[model samples]
Target: MHILILPSWYPNHANDIKGVFFRDQAQALAHYGHTIGVIALQRRSLRTLFPKKQNNKAPHFELDEGVPTYRCQVLEALPKIPYGNYFLYKRAAKTLLANYVEENGWPDLIHAHSTLFAGAVASEWGNENNIPVVITEHNSGFALNIYRPWQLKVADKATQGAQACIAVSPSLGEVLDQRLPSSKGRWEWIPNVVAERFNAPASKKYSAGPTRFLNLALMTEKKGQYDLLYGFSKLIGGGTKAELWLAGDGPIRAALQELANQLEVSSQVRFLGQVAPNQVPSLLQQVDAMVVSSHYETFGVVAAEALMAGLPVIATRCGGPECIVAEGDGLLVPPRDPQSLASAMDHIAKNLSEYSPHAIAERSKSRFSGAAVAAQLTYLYTRLLTSNSKVSQPKS
Candidate 1:
């Protein structure tokens, strides 16, 4: 099976941490014996804004972690141009497909990471070549609410044309269903996968701390970092003895740091900005629990990782986390409620033995392992390919 992935968020020289999950999936697919290739698209604007020293050396194609990647530049930079940037995405996808077909032969199926503009491009390419297209929608609640009318219309069109749709969680799939009901495609609920590397011995060794709580997301407004800090402050104020590890970097880092300072819990929270994907497991094993305060997540990959790390997770009643954190795995509080979040933290601190970090990690294997997810995805692609083959055959 020649599997081609069209991921809008892919790691590049400038943003090496971007879409590391998608890269993991691609690697898993390749390991499954599928002839996998990728057409990773980067916004031209982003590339120019952070021009790598290697930019002038031609578009050097390379194999990353065993997957063949063809990086194509999309925009000169994020365009402030007008109402919609549909043209930029379409042009990039068109160029990618053209180059892919010319150089590497046709792929059996194309799986797009987002239902944003990327789906439109995949639909166009699939239509042109009669190839099957599948889309995995990964968007926040805010984006879903703020999308323009035409954006929804384009998504509807693409959804209708797709062979199947995989939603990371039920809430996201429900939103997709409401937005585009006419699309005659099977919608499957596929959660994100965490790599085996994230699963480690809790007390075996190499953990950063003995009793730690971690927030492994970019520090941003939508991620609710400020709320997390406030909740942590409340927990500390209540005399809880736990260290907070804040991983990942974003625009809100300085502001969040200031908030921690104002709350006088700056020393308790360690900002370990941008840890590599491979290092996540060892880092997580050091922690006792993970906190996910994000208002929305298409799928909480870190929460799953924490579960895989055998650390209980304390997540908000946000769309994705509510679905992922089953009974006994963790607790969920209302989004943005510091009091409730703080209370949950206190409960965990007091009854640490109730939430077995090892049990939670074991439970995470079913939902977020690379091998499990890749098998499900491969099955979806194979089914679509076989169906397409039957349709194109001459009548018996």
Candidate 2:
């Protein structure tokens, strides 16, 4: 079956880590022998929209991760403008859909990732074009109470009209179900796909210098980087030979560094800003364990990735990590509690040899492998298409 994917967020040439999971999932589906077409809109400023002479605004088409993908650049500087989505993205989406249909024909399923505009676009356009639409929620915007009124309005319209709605974690599913009660009973909890590279760090050396703890989350307050620093400070207060790798960059990098300095853990924490997606596996393999210090998450992808790489995780009882970091695989402490997190860190550091990397990797693979995610997504698409066919047929 052919699948048309309308992603609300996608990795671009500039930001490879942004919504890259959706891209991976699309490739996974393509690997399953299904024809896939992705329409990823790059919301750019007015100046960036007008390139130095391109042929009729032809989409930058290329095969992304083995999936045929199209990047449609749209001007979205004035989000507060009237019908901003419709004018900037929705209209362009319709044109792209026409081009795609002309070349590849109508798809069996229109799967949208996230719901700011992709869900809305798929819902509106798919209905008009007589196609089944399914939306997978990835962001924690609604759960975090960060969504604007306009954003919520569009999100509701899209979800209400969708054949099915998916959330990356059970926690996120519950939050969405509450906000959109009418869309209940159609929610599925599917997680982000972990890359095939991450396997158990079975070759980890115990006496290889100071123990390294890897945290690859964005430097934000919500990510609890400060708490991690505080916890690390306490853990190493007794002169424990250890180092912290703070990966990923965000708005609060300066503040997090300052916090580390204030906590007197600055010397030990290495700030690795914005590591590429491809480099994560090696980092995981090198580290003794992974740390997820998020205050909340839809599904701690980093934690899952770490587990897949055969490294145990030290995660907070944040919204989603607790679900991924199972017993024996990792420790889950309360969010934002320095002393509790500090204690967990020290305990894990001391008992590093007790955790089985192979077991952790195997568990992660069972849940989040590309093939596994592909099977689940394909099943959902098939079910939706079958139901839609039944609904469309006249009563015999």
- Per-residue lDDT for 1-396 in model 1, tens only? 888888877878533667878887888788878988888877655535555565433253787766778886665443554424677778777887788777877777888888677777887678767788898888673235877776777778888778888888887777777767665345689887677777757564323333577899987898998888998899898887777889989999999989989999989999999987767777876678889998888788888878887888899987888877999987999999989889988887777777766677677887788888888988877788777753253211
Per-residue lDDT of model 2, residues 33-69, tens digit only = 8999999887777777657875434347887666777
Least well predicted 10-residue stretch by lDDT in candidate 2: 387-396
Which residue pairs collide, candidate 2? Answer: 199-309, 200-310
Provide the TM-score for each candidate, comma-separated: 0.89, 0.92
| C-alpha-based local distance difference test score of model 1 | 0.78
Candidate 1, which segments miss by more than 4 Å at Cα? 13-15, 46-59, 76-84, 141-143, 184-186, 202-210, 389-396
The local lDDT score (0 to 100) that residue 219 gets in candidate 2 is 82
Give the winner by lDDT: 2
